[model samples]
Target: MSLEIVDSCVGCFACEPLCPNKAISAVMQPGEPLFFINPDKCTECLGDHDLPQCAEICPIEGAIVDEYGEALNPLGSLTGIPLHLLEQMREAECRQ
Candidate 1:
């Protein structure tokens, strides 16, 4: 299994060099400028590291995901904000 980089990726290149397997790459397709993880080459860093280095280094939440489409770095993970509190803040913003 491999982590897939979604559109949310900002092409920051932070996760590229961190990949232990060299599975991550930059995709230059029009309107699709983002990093991609080669599934064939990806091993989820099982034997390499304790965690997936790409996901651990990614700055954007929900950018890297598992084969099942679950984000490795879900929202509120890197921000240190609880999901429920973040949701409440969003709701408050909408009411304003």
Candidate 2:
């Protein structure tokens, strides 16, 4: 199974080097921002590590998703960020 880096990825470099398979690549295209993981190369660290390194190290919630496109790091799991606060922030951004 492969992990997908969703749009919520803020171009963080945290997940790059940690990838044992070297599947993660920094994508800095003018319009396409964020690091990308090559699904063909990604092994989810299955044979290397017990957990997917990217998901374990990602600071932002809902940034990394599984093969089924469900976020592995759902809201507030590691960061303890309140769901309401995130919703409010999104709403505020929409107003701007």
Q: Residue 82 deviation, candidate 2, in Å? A: 2.0
Query: What C-alpha lDDT values do all the predictions have?
Result: 0.87, 0.90
lDDT for each residue of candidate 1 in 1-96, tens digit (9 for 90 to 100): 777988888988888888888998887878656787899999999999999898888888788889999999888989999999989998999999
Superposed model 1: Cα runs more than 4 Å off: 29-32, 82-96
TM, every model: 0.79, 0.89
Q: CA RMSD for every model?
A: 3.0, 1.6
| Alpha carbon deviation, residue 83, candidate 1 (Å) | 3.6
Candidate 2 residue lDDT tens string, 1-96:
799998888887989999999999987889656789999999999989999999999998889999888888898798787889988999999999
Best by TM-score: 2
